[model samples]
Target: MHSAIWTAVSLFLIVEGLGPMLLPKVWKRGIITLISSPEKLLRRFGGAFVVAGLVIFYMVNK
Candidate 1:
């Protein structure tokens, strides 16, 4: 479980970083847009994504 979690985190980090590494300008624009969004809106979006990720993880593990 520990190894699996670590590997998953590593892969997620790589995937999250790829867009910025490949297209810095677009990534910067996206960051600027995100920065301009309301805090509540970002929190809600983050909550939704967390729920979705948990559901997918449970489904795959089960």
Candidate 2:
């Protein structure tokens, strides 16, 4: 369980790093846009991502 958790975190970090490492400009623009976005919109996006992640986790485990 611990190893699986660590592997998931490592994969998440790798995926998160790729955009900034490959296309800094695009990544910067996306960050700026996200920063400018309304709080409600950001919350919705966050909620959606969490829900999606939970669903994927269930599917994978099942």
Candidate 3:
């Protein structure tokens, strides 16, 4: 059970990270449009959320 969950989470993060890197223009455009009025604090917080979520998911599954 745990192995399956970890595999899924790992795959998800790999895909998420790779998608933007592979298509920088599309990703950047989307980000700009989505967070046009974004604040630095919010951006940092969003990143923290992603990292924390990934960490939690990995720890639990591991």
Candidate 4:
């Protein structure tokens, strides 16, 4: 279980790094867009991700 958690985290790190590593310009543009977006919208978007992650985690564990 410990290693499973670490493995998931490691994969997440790799995936999170891919945006900048593969297309830095696009990533920068995305960041700029996000910066310009409304705080409420960003919070909602982040909240959605958190909910989705929780659902996935629950399904995986079950």
Candidate 3 local accuracy as lDDT?
Answer: 0.86
Q: Candidate 1: deviation at residue 55, Å?
A: 0.8
Ranking by lDDT: 2, 4, 1, 3
User: Which whole-number lDDT from 0 to 100 does residue 16 have in model 4?
Assistant: 92
Query: How would you encode candidate 3's per-residue C-alpha lDDT over 1-62 as one tens digit per residue?
Result: 89988988999899889859899899888778767766886788889999998899889879
TM-score order, best first, reads 2, 1, 4, 3
Model 2 Cα lDDT, one tens digit per residue, 34-57? 999999999999999999999999
Tens-place lDDT per residue, model 1, 1-62, is 89999999999999999998999999999999999999999999999999999999999999
Candidate 4 structure quality by residue, lDDT tens digits, 30-58? 99999999999999999999999999999
Q: For model 1, which pairs clash?
A: none
TM-score of each: 0.91, 0.98, 0.47, 0.88
On lDDT, the stronger of 3 and 4 is 4
Q: Which stretches of candidate 4 lie over 4 Å from their true place?
A: none
Deviation in Å, model 4, residue 28 alpha carbon: 0.7
Q: Output the better candidate (1/4) by lDDT.
A: 4
TM-score of model number 1: 0.91
Model 3 spans > 4 angstroms off? 36-62
* Superposition TM-score, candidate 2 onto the true structure: 0.98
RMSD of every candidate to native, in Å, equals 0.9, 0.4, 6.3, 1.1
